[model samples]
Structure formats: structure tokens, C-alpha cells
Target: MLKKVLIANRGEIACRIVRTGHRLGVATVAVYSDADRDALHVRLAGEAVHIGPSPAVESYLRSDRIIDAALRSGADAIHPGYGFLSENPDFAGAVAAAGLRFIGPPATAIRAMGLKDAAKALMEKAGVPVVPGYHGADQDPDFLLGEAGRIGFPVLVKARAGGGGKGMRRVETAAAFKEALASARREALAAFGDASCLIEKYIAHPRHIEIQVFGDDHGNVVHLFERDCSAQRRHQKVIEEAPAPGMPEAMRLAMGEAAVKAAQAIGYSGAGTIEFIADASEGLKADRFWFMEMNTRLQVEHPVTEAITGVDLVEWQLRVASGEPLPKRQEELSIDGWAFEARLYAEDAERGFLPATGMLAHLDLPDDLARVDSGVRAGDRISPYYDPMIAKIITHGPDRTAALSRLSDALAQVRAAGVTTNAAFLRRLTIQPDFAEGRPDTGLIDRHLTELTMVHAAPPEVAALAALSFSGTLAARKTNDPWALLSGFRLWSGASDFILLEHRGQPLPVSFLSKGEGNYRVLLEGRDVDLRISSSPDAFRVEVDGRTSTLHEVHDGKATTVFRDGESWHFTLADPLAGEDEAAAAGDRIVAPIPGLVKLLHVAPGAAVSRGEALAVMEAMKMELALPAPRDGRIAEVLVSQGEQVLEGAVLLTLEVEDG
Candidate 1:
């Protein structure tokens, strides 16, 4: 085995690699940018080195700096954990030329499958089934348009060099083809520095099924079953599971064999995934699947494979990189049970799933029933320079139904504040009728978005509890003094104290008259509730309407947050003595929701725009967000121009409401 391994990445994947390396008695080294100086991965590694500034181009993608750090730290091998430089064949070759082992596929294999166009050609020659598309190198707009017509409408114009859905767009008709092509190319050039693209026939109702393949230096390769990643948004995966639901023995064998063939065609070594887009309009069958693309490194969803097969993929990467043979043959590997992985991201699901950034005030995750892979703690900040994924919640059970149930329960038990999250949305998605029946497809989220994204108001009882916790009334009950016990208590006259709070832009008053003995009568919005409250180390038990429930609360002075049954609410304390000011009217101004660079200005000052028209485009966290005009009006002031970096709530422009 290698003596020491340097992880050339950051975040949860980096932390994951360090854990496995340490477990195998191999010292680990971590490289970080300026933003990740105090990151969890840096703290977990045996030795750490600062590479460059926070921008990924200056730090994480700097192969020279990463190579130097590895050599300086005496690392014998380098593990590029999926992203940044993981699939860059040039970087792999650079590391190998520096006398350091690259813990991934050989540079030739990476080059063979680096570009989608070239890789599909290679797969077609190797007799691996590929999707019908245009992979030719003619970049003229007219030529591409003709090809689109040939392939049929609803074609996907994808960047040949892109992943993570950055430079991809789906066109539904010929009328939208020109605009979609220009947009896709613009994003492609900005993201990958390559304006070239490929056109593919869009598969309706497709399921994203991928096979995990491993290879060793001894020219041996094997497949570790497959993962069903059909649940997706914005062309990115959300929930993934192993032993694809309703997968038959014959179909699994066919996909597994084709995956091994794709890997062997490139002489692939180490860990890689062969992703296939299956036409599930019918059902999963051997002939319905076609090759999509091959990821030439470890995957983010590898944990689900680990939970089901009892195999550590990182361990296999290390062993294979150290000149070892394949750990097990194809016949020896078999699935044990079922597993699920839900990606918890710091993104608001209600607001178009825009990424969020802030300091984590409190984070409480469930244990015992699930395994959490996280690179952040309670106090860490979610920076704007990186991906906003907080953690991967993994659950295992004896069957698919049991595993899905455990995953639903585990997501509910997670409590976090200070940054908006998709946890609530994830909880709703898990219980959807189609999802429960294992009938998820790539269009599942988009098709049922209205029902899945329903927003619920916080109950008045929850706000009352927050008020008690914030005012120290809940903690004072443990005191010995008689006066403290009766702090908020009133006599027979029935006097009540009003606690003012603001939630969802509305003022809520909670009136309470304590009866002592941890009992109180609370009135909120004209509704009365009789409750008894008690506190334990982990949660507060409240009995209301003859029903008792346990809840967790976190307060950060600015916002008091309460979590109950997989849902959360934030209430900001309102000043009772101060006079309230008139709220600002809507559609007056447009502001940025997150810090990002203005990529384009679609409207100039004094330019008239219709309601819901795209006014500007902002790039944040590597995703482009279109700032739409709130109403039919003219742009009053253009506060920002293209290429300017703006902070959250920084007004990009204002609109002068058009007279009716």
C-alpha cells in the first residue's frame, strides 16, 4: 500500500478519503484554498497545506500548486476526489510524470473518455450501445440547426466538455432552437472554455441508472451492481439508491456486462461509473438502456454502493493504485440489501432552489439509524466559492421499502438553522406516491413541482414555544426561588403578557398567562391553547390538546428556530414598544438573492420590459440565475453591469411601475 496519500480536493469527499486512508494506516495530506483554511477536511488530515486563493481556478484547479504541495508533504500518491481536476487527463499525466502515483484511471483512459463526442465514438466502435445524436465537429449554427431537425425536436444541446448540467439546455421546438443554442454555447464557453457542443435526441421519461466499475493494474475489472439516480433537478441528481427498484435479473446482467465492456475498452483502472440513460416509458429492460457518459473518478453517490455491498470504494482505489489485483471477481460480488442516499444542500427549494450561504447557528443531525458524511459542523460558514452541499444522509435496511422508510425518518430528525435548506422538500419528496412506488424518472421533480413545493405556515403553538425559550422562561423553571417559578403567572384577573414576533413577513402576537408548575394558557391569533412544558437534554416535551410531542429549538438572537416532525420555522423577535413602519411595496426593486457575478444585462436603463421577462443573469455557485422583471415597467436605474460581483440583497436595478 502507499505510505501517504494527498487528497487534491476539499469538502465531504476529501474528508471521506482521509477517513479511509487513516483506517488503512496510511497517513493523509490535505490541500486547501484560502476559503477552506479552517475547513473540516483540513482538520481531519494528518498534514495540511495552503495552495492558493479561494477561487477554484487559482487554487483547487491549479495542478502545479497541488503537485508541489503533495511533494512537499512527502505524499507518495495523490487522490483527486471527483471534481476540479479529477477527470482532467492532463493533470493525471502531470502527477504521474512527477514520480507520484495518481490514484485514478490511467491518463490514456481518461483521455479516451474525456470528451462526450469522442467517448461515444469509441463506445460505438466497441459495440457498446450509445444514444442517437450528432457528434460531428461542424460548429456552424446552420449545420447544427439542420442536425437538430434530423434528430427531431426536443433535442438536448449539451456541452461536449461539461458535467453537472452547467452547459446544457433542452429545446422543445424549432422556434426556440436558435436562442437555446446561443445560451448553451455562452454558458459552455464561460464554464468549460469550450464553445463546441453535441446534439442528442432527448429521451422522454428516462431513468438515470449508472454502474460502478472497478479495475486493477492486473488488467482485471468488475462491476459493483448499479445505482438508480432518477430523482433529479436542474439535470443534477437528488436522491440515489442501490439495487435499482424493480430491476430484473436479466436486465441487471445486461447493463453490468455493457458497463464492464465500456471500462475495458479504455483499459480503465481504479474507480469509474458508466452512466446509462434508460427509456423507462415502458419498464426497465436490457435493450432499452443506452450509454450516456462515463465519470472517470469516484462518485458522490458511492456511499450507497458501500452500504449495500459492504465495500469501501476508496480502499479499492488505494489498493489498485498500489499495484494490487482486483479485490473480487464479478461472480464473487453480490448485493446484500438495499440502501438510499439523500443529498442535503444549503439551497432554498421554495425560491427556485437557489443556493444559500450563511453561518450555521445550530445543526442537529440524527444518529444510530443512518450514517452522515459531512464536511461542515455547527459553526462553519457556507461560502460562496464552493458547492453548497452540507451532507449526504445514507440509510440501509433489509429491503427497498424499509430503506425508503428509514431515509424518510432520518431526514425528519435533522435540525439545522441560519441557512435555508432543502431538507423539508426532501422530506416531502420521500413520501410522494410515485416515489414511494419506485417510479421516479428524470422529470419527476419538474412534473409534480406544484404539489411537492407546497409551503406551510408555522403553527401558533410553535411560535409560543419559541417565545418562551427566547425569554428564558423555559429555563427558569429549574430555579429554586418561588418568584422565578411564578415569573409569567397571573392571578384570577387573567392578565396576559404579549410576545411579538415576525414570521414570513407577518407580525404574530403570542399571549401567555403562566399558571406555575410548568403550565400555561397561551393565546395566539385568537386561538387558545392549554399546555404543559418540560425540558430534557435533547428536546422539549409539550403537552397540548391532550397530545404530547417532543421538539427542538435553536435561537441565534436574530431568529428563533423551532423544529418539529421534519419541518422548521423561523421567528424573528419583534419590538413591542417601537412603532411599526409601513412595509415596502412589492415590485419596486430587484435585488440579488445570493452573492454572485452579473453575467449579462438583458435590459439597460430606461428599457421597457414585460412582467416575468428576463432582466439579467447572475452566476453564483457555478449556476446561472435569471433575474426576472417583477412587473411590466421600464428599468429606472441599472445599478450593476455585466461582470460585476454583487453581494446578497444588492439591488441590481429598479423598475418604474408602468401606469395602467
Candidate 2:
């Protein structure tokens, strides 16, 4: 067993690795950038080293800095905890050169599977089914266009060098091919430093099924079954589950064999996942699955595999790095139950799922059957310097239905504060009728986006709880006239207390009354709501019917109060009547919604435009959002230039409202 293992990454994965290392009596070392000094993973490690600055390119991706940190910490081996440098063959080679064991495959295997174009060709030669496409190296635009014509319309243009759908585009017609190809190539170059792309036939209503293959240095490998990652947004995996729902036995065996063979063809070892995109229009069939790509490191969704197989893949990685043989044989490995993993992102799902950032004023999660794998705690800031994935919520049970039920309950109980999150959206997805019935495909979210993302506003009763949670503020203000904040029936009647908050940037005022001491009644819009308070000075629990929400108060001798109730939360004003005219106007302008590079500017000074015309492009959180003209008007002035860094809501261009 390895005594000390250095985790070559940061965030929740680092914390996750430390836990398993501790369980096996192995010391864990953590490396962090300046941006992550206060991160949860750094505090959890047995030893720590600061690698470099905040930017990942200069820090986490620095192989030399990581190797030096490992040597200084006296770590016997290194675990590339997904992303960062996990699949970099040169980094693997350098680790071996520095006399440190890399807890992954040999450099040769990484090189073989590093490029998609080459990997697909290799899989084809190995007799594994590959999607029909043009993998040739001709970079002529017209040549590729002709290839697309031969492959039929609706071909997928994918970056040869990267994954995550970053440089991928789906073309439906020849007229859209050239523009898509150029855009895809540009994005591919920006993200992967390689503009080369491969065209593949697009599968309609595809189901993404991936096989988890584990190999050892002893030339042995076995499959840990498959995961169904059909639910997604913008081609990114959102919800993943093990032992794919409605999987045919014949298809499972065939996919497993193909995946294992692909791994063997590359002389792969350690933990790697082989992804296959299947045509689900006909349901999962043994012959319909085609090779997508191979991930050469531990995956973010690895927990689902562990949940069903009852195996600790991290421990297996450690054992294999120490020159051990396969721990288990193919026949010995089997799935026991169903498992689901829902990715909780700090994003506004209602607003194109734009990544959100703010301090986690309060965070809470239940631990019944759901397991939370996260890096941030309450009070931590969700920064734009990295990915906005807050956590992964995993649940397991005897079957898929049970796991899904567990997922829904757990998502509802998660209270995150200080930022907008997708908690409510995730909850809705779990309880979706089609999702509950195992009828989801990759296009499910897109097909029913309106239904899937209809934001679940706080219930009327929750609004009541929101009122009571902030009612304490009124008590402090009306100290002189205690009756001012107090509500009761003329000793038996009730008095209504008004509360104000901003939901989705719209000002909404709510009213609630004190039924009695500590108990309250709330009216939202025009509906009456009930609240049951069960709290002490430090915290309060408000229960309504069957749903319960916890509220934590923060008093800084001010008028603005934050009402934190799980990830689904908002701020409240201790005095709503006084904040009616605090809006910024004139010289003050609109700001960017989130931190990102300014991608495009649509107007200039003296330019006339109508309401809803494209204004500018602000690229944040990897997605581009168009800022539209707020009102029909002529441009008074352009406030910021393209490529300027502006804070959230900073005006890019100001418009002069036109005269009637």
C-alpha cells in the first residue's frame, strides 16, 4: 500500500481522494492555486502545497510545480483527480521520469487514446463499431463539406483534441455546414489549441451509455457495467445513472466487450471510461452502439459506478500504481443495485443555466440515502475562476425508481445561499413523469425545456416562512412600539406584516401575520399561507404541511436582510417600505450578469435601435448570452468596449429612450 499519495488536482475530487486515502491509512497531500488556498480540499488534506497563481493554466496544469510539490511532500505516488492534467500523456511520462508513480495508465496508452480522430480509427481497426464519419486529415473546408454530404445531412462536427462538446456542432443542412464548421473550428482552437475536427453521423435521439473499464499492469481488465447519461443540457451531462435503465442484456454484454477491447487495443491500465452513443430511437440494441470517445482518467461521475459495483476505484488506482495485479476478475464483478447522480450547479437554469457566483451565506443538505460530494461550504464564494459545479448528489437503492425518489427528496432539502443555483431545477427533473418512467434520451431536456426548467418558485407557505424568518428584523426596529411588529387577533384577530424581496430581478412584496407568538401566516400575491416556526436564537425551522424550510439570520446593523433557505433562497428587507426607489439610474448603467470576457459589441454611439435588438455578447461560464436593447431607443452612448472586463450588471451600451 502506498504511504503517501499526492492528489494532482483540487476541489471536491481532492477531498474525495483524501477520504479514501485516510481509510486505507495512506497519507494524502494536496496542491492548490492561490484561488484555492481557502478551498475545502486544501483543509482536508494531510499535507498541503501552494502550486502557483489563481489561473489554472499557470497552476494546476503546471506539471513541474506538481512534481516538485509531490517530491517536497515526500508523497510516494500521484493521483490525477480528473480534469486538469489527468489525461496528459507528457505529464504521465514526466511523473515516471521524476521517479513518482502516476496512478493512471502508461504514457503509451494515453497517447493512443488522446486524439479523437486517431482513437476512432484505432477502434475501427480493432473491430469495434465506430460511427460512420470522415476522420481524414484534409483541412480544406470544401472537402469536409463534401464529406458531410456523403455522410448525409445532420453530421456532428467534433473537436479532434477535446471533449465536453466544447468544439462540437450538429449540422442539419448543407447550408448551415460551413458556418458551423468555421465556428466549431474557432471554438475548438480556443478551447483545445487544435482546430482539427472530425465529422460523424449524428444519431437522432441518442442515448449516451459508457462502460467503466478497470485495468492493471498485469495485462488484465474488466468492465464495471454501464451508465446512462442521456439527460443533458447543451451537450453536457447533467443526470447520470448506473445499470442503464431499460438496458437490454445482450446490448450490455456487447458494449462491455467492445469497451474492454478498445482499452486493450491501447494497452490501457488504471481507471478509464469508454463512451458509446447509441441510437435510442429503436431502444438499446447490441448492434446500434458506436464508439464515442475514451476518457483517460477518473470521471466526475465515477461515484455512480462505485455505488452499484460496491468497489472503491480510487483504492484500486492506488493498488495498481504500487505494482499490484488485478484485484478482481471479470466474472467476480457484478452490479447489485441502481444508482443516480445529479450534478448540482451554481447556475440560473431559468436564464439559460448561466453560471452564478456569490457567497454561500448558508448551506444545508440531508444525509438520508443521498450522498453529497462537494467542495464548497456555507460562507465560501463561488468564483468565476473555475467551473461552477457546486456538487454531485448521488443516491442508491434496490432499483431505479427508489434511487430517483431518494434523489428528489434530497434535492428538495438542499439549502444553498448567497448565489443562484439549479437546485429547484434538479428537483423538478427527478420527479418529471417521463424521467420517472425511464423514457429519457439525450434530447429529452431540449424537447421539454419549458416543462423541465419552469422554475419552482417558493410555495405560498414558504413565502410565509420567508416572512417570519425575517420578521425578527421588524421586532428589533419596533422595539419602542412592540405592537408594531406583533400581530394577533384584537387579542384574537390577526395583524398582517409586510415583507419585500426580489425574485428573478422582479420586486415582489409578500405579507404574513402572526397567528400567535413565533407562529405566522403569509399571503403571496393573493393567496394566504401558513407557517409553523420551530427555532432557537441561532437558527429557525419553519414547517408547512409536509415541506420544511430552515432559515438562518444575519444582522449587521443594517436594513437589508438575507433569508437563506437551502439552495433555493433570496434576500429580504427588514424594512420594505423604505426601499421603493433605490434603483440606479442615469450615469449608472447595466452590468454583466456574471464574470466573463466580453465577446461582441452590437451598437456604437448615436446608433438607433429598437427594443429587443441584439445589443452585445457577453461570454460567461462558457456560454454566450445576448444582451438585448432594454427599450426602443437610439444609442446615447456605448459604455464599454468589446473585450472589456465588466462586473455583473455593468452597462455595455446605454440607450436614450426615444420620444413618443
Candidate 3:
């Protein structure tokens, strides 16, 4: 085994590698950029090296810096953990040239499968099933348009060099083809530095299934079954599970064999995944699946595979890299159970799932109920310089129903604040009819988007809890002083204390007359209710109108958040003395919703645009968002230029005022 290894990545994947390395008695070194100086991964490693600034281009993506850090730390091997330079063939070559072992596949294999267009061609030559598409090198827009027409409408324009849905778009018609192509190319170039693309026939009702394959340097390869990742949003995976639901035994065998063939064709080594796009409209069939692409390194959803197979993939990677033979033969491997993983992201589902950044004032996950893989702690900040994924919640059981039930319960128990999240959305998806019934497609979320992203108002009980926390009633319960208790008492009559709280811009007035002894009569919005409240170190017990329940609350000095039954509601103490400010109405200015670089400007000064017209495009968190005109108006002035980095709420342009 390698004595010392350097992790060439950050976040949860890096921290995950460190734990395994320690368990195996291998010293681990961590490299971090400026943004991750005090990150959890840096604090977990045996040695740490400072790479560069916050941006990935100047740090994690720099092969020279990573190689230097590995050599300087005396690490015998470097583990590229899933992202960054993990799939970069040049980086693999550089690591080997620096005399450090690359804990991944050979450079030759990575090169052979690095680009989707070229990889598809190679898979065809190897007799592996491939999707029908135009994989040629023709870059002419007119020619590509003709090809898309020939391939039929509803084709996918995908970046040739990278994955992760960075540079991918689905064109439904010829009229929308050119714009989608331009957007895909721009995103592809920005993300992978390669704008070249390939057109593929989009599977209308597709299910993303990938087989986990491992190979040793001694020409031995074996498959670890498969993972289903059909639950997606914006072309990115949201949930993943091992042993795809509704997978036929025959189809599974065929896919597993084809995956092994693809890996053997490239002389691959270490951990890799053979991703296939299945046309599930007609159920799972042997000939209905096609090879989509190959991920030449560990995947983000590898935990699900480990849970069911009872195998440590990272350990296998290290052993194979150390010149060991296959861990087990084909007959020796078998699935033990069902496993499910849900990606919990710091993003607002109500805002089109835009990535959010803020301090994690409070964070908690039910580790006892499930496996929680996270890189951030309470007080950690979610920066805009990288991905906004907070953690991954994984659960396993003897059967799919049992495992999925556990997953639902675990997601419901999550508690977080100070940043918007998709916890509620994920829980809703778990119970969604099609998903719960084991019939899921790539378009599942899209088909039920309205129900999935709907933000329901907080229940009256939740609002009452928030009000109690903000009123100091819950805090005062911890003390023994009678005078400190907020019991509205007087010499001759019972006095009522009134407090105002705001939720989602609406003010709620709450009045309470404490009845003493943990009992009170509360009035909120003209509805009267009796409450008895108590607290322990970890939770609060409240009785609302004679029904008892336990709840959790997090106070961040500025806002009070209440968590109940897998949903959260945030409230702020309203300043009754403050007056409302007179400000400009909406659409007066076009401001960025998040901090990002301006990718394009569709309109200049004095240009007229109607409501919902695309005015500008901003790139952030590896995704592009098109800014739309809020109303029919003419541009008065353009404040920012293309390629300029701007903060959230930065005005990009202004609309001229209407003539009275």
C-alpha cells in the first residue's frame, strides 16, 4: 500500500478520502485554495498545502501546483477525488511524470474516454451499444442545424469535453437550435475550455443508469452492478440509488457485461463508471439502453454503490494503484440490499433552484438514522467560488420500500438555517407518486415541478413557535427567576404583551397573556389558543390547544427558524417602531439574483424589451441563468459589461421611466 497520499480535491470528497486513508494507516495530505483555507478537509488531513486563490482556475485545476504540493508533502500517491482534475488526462500524465502514483485510471484510458464524441465513436468500434447521434467534427452552425433536423427534433446539444450538465441543452425545434447551440458552446468553453459539441437524439422518457466498474493494472476487471440517477433538475442529478428499480435481470446482466467491455477496451484501471441512458418508455429491455459516456474517476454517488455491495471503492482504488490484483472475482460479488442517496444542496427551490451562499448559522443532520456525508459545519460559510452542495444523505435497508422509508424519515429530520435549501423539496420528491411507485424518468421532476417547488405557508403552530422564541418565552424557561419570566401580570388585571413578527414580508401580530406555570393564552391574527411550553437541552415540548408535540428551533440573532415534520419556517422580529421606506418599484432596475460573471448582454442602452424577454445572462456555480425583463420597458443605461464579476443585487442596467 502507498504510505502517504495527497488528496487533489476539496469539500466532502476530500474529507471522505482522508478518513479512509487514516483507517488504512496511510498518511494523508490536503491541498486547499484561499477559499478553503479553514475548510473541514484541511483540518482533517495529516498535512496541508496552500495551493492558490479562491477561483478553481488558479488552484485546484492547476496540475503543476497539485504535483508540486504532492512532492513537497512527500506523498507517494495522489488521489483525485471525483472532481477538479480527476478526469483530466494531462493531469494524470503530469502526476506520473512527477514520480507520484495517480490513484486513477491510466492516462491513455482517460484520454480515450475523456471526450463524449470521441468516446461514443470508440464504444461503437468496440461493439458497445451507443446512442444514435451526429458525433462528427463539423463545427459549422448550418451543418449542425441540418444534422439536428435529420436526427429529428428534441435533440441534445452536449459539450464534448466535460459532464455535470454544464454545457448541455435540449433543442425542441429548428428555430431554437442556434441560440441553444450558442449557449451550450459558451458554457462548454467556460467550464471545460472546449466549445466543441456533439448532437444526440434525446430520449423523451429516459432513465440514467450507470454501472460501477473497477479494473486492476494486471488486465483484470469486474463490475459492481449499477446505480439509477433519474431524479434530476436542470439536467443535474438530484437523487441516486443502487440496483435500479424495475431493472430486469437480463438487462442488468447485459449492461454489466457491456460496462466491463468498455472498461477493458480502454485498458482502464482503478474506479470508473459506465453511464447509460435508457429509453424507459417501453420498460427495461436488453437493446433499449445505450452507452452515454464514461466517468474515469470516482463518482459523487459512489456511497450508494458501497452500501449495497459492502465494498469500499476508495480502498479498491488504492489497492489497484499499488499494483494489487482484483479484490474479488465476478462470482464473489453480490448485492446485499437496497441503498438510496439524496443530494442536499444549499439552493432555493422557489427561485428556480439557484445556488445560495451564506453562513451556516445552524446545521444538523440525522446521522443516527442515515449516513450523512458533509464538508461544512455550523458556522462554515457556503462560498460562491464553488459548488453549493451542502451534504449527501444516504440510507440502506433490506428492501427498496424499507430503504426509501428510512431516507424519507432522515430527510425530514434535517435542520438547517441562514441559507435557503431544498430539504423540503427533496422530501416531497421522495413521496411523489411516480418516484414512490418505482417509475421514474429524467423528466419526473419537470413533469411535477409545480407540486415539487410549491412553497406552502407555515402552519399556525409553526408560526406560534417562532413567535415564542422571538418573544424570549422559550429562552426565559431556562432560568429560575420569577421576575424574568414573561408572564403578563399586574396588580389588578391581567396585562397582555403584544409582539410583531414578519414572515415572507408579511407582518403577524401576536398577543399573549401568560397564565403562569408554563401556560399561556395566545392570540394570533384574531385566533386564540392555549399553550403549555417546556424545554430540554436539545428540544422543546409544546402543547398547542391540548395536543402535545416536540419541535426544534434555531435562533441566529437576526431570524428565528422553526423545524417541524421535515419542513422549516423562518421569521424575523419586526421593529414596530421602524417606518417603511419609499423605494422604487420592481423592474426599475435589472439586478443580479446571485454573484456571478456577466456572460452575455442581449440588449444595449435604449433597446426596447417586453416582459420576460431575455436581457442578459449570468454564469455562476457552473450554471448560466438568463435575466429577463420584468416588464415592457426601454433600457435607460447599461451599468455592467460582459465578463465582469458582480455581486448579488448588483444592477446590470436600468429601465426608463414611463411618461405620466
Candidate 4:
């Protein structure tokens, strides 16, 4: 085995590689950008090296800098963990030429599958069933439009290079093809430096199923079953599972065989995944699936595969890189149980899943029933320069039911504060009736989005708990006054203590007739309720209407975030002395809701735009969001142009409201 290995990546994937290296007694080296200097992966590795600035182009994507760091740190092998330079053929060849082992496939294989158009052609030659698409070299917009017409309406325009839904779009009609193609090409160019694209027939009910394939230098390759990643949003996977819920043995065997063939055809080695889009409008069958593309490195969802197959994929990568044969043949590999993985991201699901950035003042996760693969600590900052993935929570059980149940429980117990997260949304998705029954497709999230993103404000019991917590603060403020020694003390009956709090931006007034000893008859919205409160350093126990419940609380002076039953509620104390201001009148101004780089501006000054028309496109957190016209107006001023970075609430355009 390689003695020392360098991980050329950041975040959880880097930490994951370091873990396997440590278990195998191989010292690990980590490379970090300026933003990740205090990142968790840096602290986990045995050796660390500084590469460049925070921008990925200056640091993580700098192949020369990565090679220099590997050599300086005495790393014998380099493991490009999934992103950055993982699939770059030039980087792989450079590492090999430098007398260092690249813990991935040969550079030739990477080049063969680097472009989707070329990879699809290669797969067809290898007798692997590929999706019906136009993979030619013609780049003329007019020619591409002709190809799209031939393929049929409701087609897909995808970037030939790179993944992660960066440059993929679904064109629903012929009229939208021209604009969609331009958008896709722009995104592709920004993301992969390639403006090439391919057109394919869009699958109406697609289920993303992929087989994990690994090979060794000794001409041995095997498959590790499959993972179902049907639940997605904007082409990004939200949840994934192994041993697909309703997979049959015959189809499973066929997919495994085809994936192995694809790997062996290119003399591929190390861990890779062959992703297929299955037409599940019927059911999963051997003939209903077609090859999409191959991920030339370890996947983010590999943990679920590990949980089911009892295989450490990273260890396999290392073993293969060390010139070893396949550890297990296809016949020997077996699925043990079912597993589920939920990607926990630092994002607000209610805000169109926009990524969030903040200091993690408090972080709590379940450890008993699930495995949390994370790269951020309690004090870590979720930076906008990188992906906002907080962790991957994986659960295993004897069957899908048990695994999903455990996953729901684990999500509920998560207590992450000081930043908005999708934890609550994930919990809701797990327990949704259709999701619990394993009947979901790529459209499941979007179909049930309204209900899934519904925010549940603090209940009366939770509000009482927040009130009690705030009372403690009031008591602390009077520590120097003997006259106000007892903040909760009441001398007469029916003497109400008034307090105000806000939940989900709504003011709530709470009044309680204190009877002393932490007991009170609280009145909220004119309804009287009896309550008892007890607090400890770890948790708060509140008895509401004769029912007792315990909650974990984190207060940052301004707001108190309470977690209960797998969801979090943030409450802020409303000051009675504060005056209410009139609502801002709707104006002819468009401001950015979040900080992002403007990718495109659809209009110039004096251009007339209709309501809900796309005005500009902004890219942030590796995702693209379009800013639309708030009302029908004519553009009067454009503050930010393409490729310019703007902060949150920065006005991008000023418009003159159209007269009636």
C-alpha cells in the first residue's frame, strides 16, 4: 500500500479520505485554500499544505500547485477526491509523469470519458446501451437547433464536460430551445471552460440509478450493486439509497455486468460510478435504462454503498493504486442490508434552497443510530466560496423501512443553529407518505414543494419555553438591585407579568399570572393556559396543558433557537419599547436577495419588461438563480453588469413603473 497519500480536495470528501488512510496506516496530507485554513479536513490530516487563495480557480483547480504541495509534503500518491482536479486528464498525467501515483484511473481512461459527447460514443462502441442523443461535433446553433427538432420537443441540453447539473437544462418546447441552448452554453463555459453541448430526449419519469464499479491493475474489475438517487432538486440529488427499493435480481445483475464492462473496456481502475437514467414510468427493467455518464472518482453517496455492502471504497482506491488486484470478485460481493443517505446542507429550503453562510455557534448530530460524515466543527464558518454541504447522514437497517425510520429520527435530533439549514426540510421529506413508501421520482420534491417548504412557527408550548429562558436574562440584568431581587416574584394574585416574543416574523404577546415557584397561568391570544417550567444546563423541560416536553435551546443574545421533535424554531424577544415602522412601498427597484456574481443581464436601460420576466441571472453557492422583474416596468438604470459580484440587498436595476 502507498505509505503517504495527499488528498487534493476539501470538505467532507477530504476528511473521508483521511479517515480511510488512517485506518490503513497510511499517513495523509491535506491541501487547503485561504478560506479553508481552519476547515475540519485540514485538522484531520497528518500533514497540511497551503495552496492558494479562496477562489477555486486560484487554488483547488491549480494542478501545478497541487503537484508541488504533494511533492513538498512527501506524499507518494495523490487522491483527487471527486471534484476539483479529480476528472482532469492533464492533472492525472502530470502526477504520473512526476513519479507519483494518481489514486484513480489512467489518464487515457479519464480522457476517454471526460466529455459526455465522446463518452456516449465510446459507450455505444463498447456495446453498452446509451441514451438516444446527438453527440456530434457540430457546434453551429442552427445545426444544433435542427438536431433538437429531430430529437423531438421536451429534450435536454447538457454540457459535454463537468457534472453537478451546472450546464444542464430541460427544453419543453421548440420556442424555448434557442434561449435554453444559449443559457446552457454560458453555464458550461463558466463551469467547465467548454461551450460544447449535446441534446438528448428528456425522460418523463426518470429515476437516477448508478452502479459502483472498481478495478485493479491486474485486469480484474467488479461491481458493487447500485444506488437509487431519484429524489432531486434542480438536477442536484437530495437523498439517495442503496439496493434500490424495488430492484429485481435479474435487472440488478444486468446493470452490474454492463457497468463492469464499461470500466474494463477502457482498462479503468480504482473507484468509479456509471450513472444511468431509468424510465420508471413503467418499472425498473433491464431494457428501460440507458447510460448517462460515468463519474471518474469516488461519489458523495458512497457511504450508503459502504453501509450496505460492507466495503470501504476509499480503501479499495488505495489498494488498487498500490498495484493490488480486486479485493472481491463480482460473485463474492453481496448486499447485507438497506441504507439511506440524506445530504444536510447549510441552506434555506424556504428561500428556493439558496445557500446560507454563517458561524456555526452550535452544532449537534445524532451518533447512536446513524453515521455523520462531516467536515465542519461547531465554530466553523460556512463560506460562500465553497459548497455549503454540512454533512451526509447515513443510516443502515435490516430493510428500507427500518433504515428510513432511523434516518427520520436522526434528522429530528439534529440541532444546528446560528445558520439556516435544510434539516427540517429533510425530516419532512423522509416522513412524507410517498417517500416513506419508496414511490418517488426526480419530480417528487418539486411536486410536493409547497408542503415540504412550509415553515411551522413556534407552538404555544415552545413560546412559553422561550419566555422562561428570556426571564432568566431579565433576572441576570437585575443582579445588582436588591429591590428587584426576584424577577419572577409576585406578591398578589392575578398580577400578570407581560413579555413579548417574535416567531417567524410575527409579534406574539405573552402574559402570565405568576403563582411563584416557576409556576404560572399563561395567557396567549386571550387563551389561558397552565404551565410549569424547569431548566437545566443541557435542556429545558416545560409542562404545557399537563403535557411535559423537553427541548434543546441555543441562544445568541438576539435570537433563541429551540429544537424539538426533529425541527428547529428560532424566536427573538420583541421589545415593547421598539416602534413599528410603516411597510416599505413597492418601488421600481430590483435588489439581490443574496450575494452572488451576475452571470447575465437580459435587458439594457430603457428596455421594457413585463412582470415576472427574467431580468438577470446570478450565480452563487455553485447554483444559478434568475432575478425576475417584480412588476411591468421600463429599465431606467443597471447598477451591476455581467461577471460583477454584488452583496445581499445591493440594488441591481432601477425601473420606471409603467403608467396605467
Please, what is the whole-model Cα lDDT of each candidate in the order they appear? 0.89, 0.82, 0.90, 0.88
- The true-structure Cα RMSD of candidate 3 reads 2.6
- lDDT tens readout by residue for model 1, 599-635: 8899888898898999899887767889888888788
Model 2 lDDT at residue 15: 89
lDDT of 4 by residue, 1-660 (tens): 899999999999999999999999999999999999999999999989999998788999999999999999899999999877999899999999999999999999999998999999999999899988899999898898888899888899999998888889999988899899999999899888999999999999899999999989999989999999999988789999998977888999889989998998899999999999999888788888899999888899999999999999998999999998988888888999899999999998977788887789899988887999999989898877788999999999999999999999999988988888999999999998988999878899999999999878677777766676676633333246755645655455444667788876688888766665557687788788887766665776778867888888887777788888887887888767755331222357888877778889999999999889999998778877888898887999999979898877889998884566
Candidate 1 stretches greater than 4 Å from native: 140-153, 174-179, 478-482, 490-492, 575-582, 585-589, 601-616, 629-646, 651-660
lDDT of 3: 0.90
Give the range where candidate 2 is weakest over 10 consecutive residues by summed lDDT: 556-565
lDDT of 2 by residue, 91-176 (tens): 99999999999999999999999999999999999989999999989989999999999999899999999888899999999999
Across residues 313-415, which tens digit of lDDT does each residue of candidate 3 receive?
9989889988999889999999988999999999888778988887899999889999999999989988878888899999999999999999999999999
**Candidate 3, superposed: residue stretches over 4 Å from native:** 139-154, 171-195, 575-581, 585-592, 598-616, 629-660
Top of the candidates by lDDT: 3
- Once fitted onto the true fold, the runs of candidate 2 whose alpha carbons sit more than 4 angstroms away are 473-496, 512-571, 574-588, 597-646, 651-660
What does the lDDT come to for candidate 1?
0.89
Report residue 624 deviation for candidate 3 (angstroms): 2.9
- CA deviation > 4 Å runs, candidate 4: 139-153, 172-183, 473-485, 493-495, 574-592, 595-618, 627-660
For model 3, name the residue pairs that clash: none
Each prediction's RMSD to truth = 2.6, 4.1, 2.6, 3.5
Each model's number of backbone clashes?
A: 0, 15, 0, 1
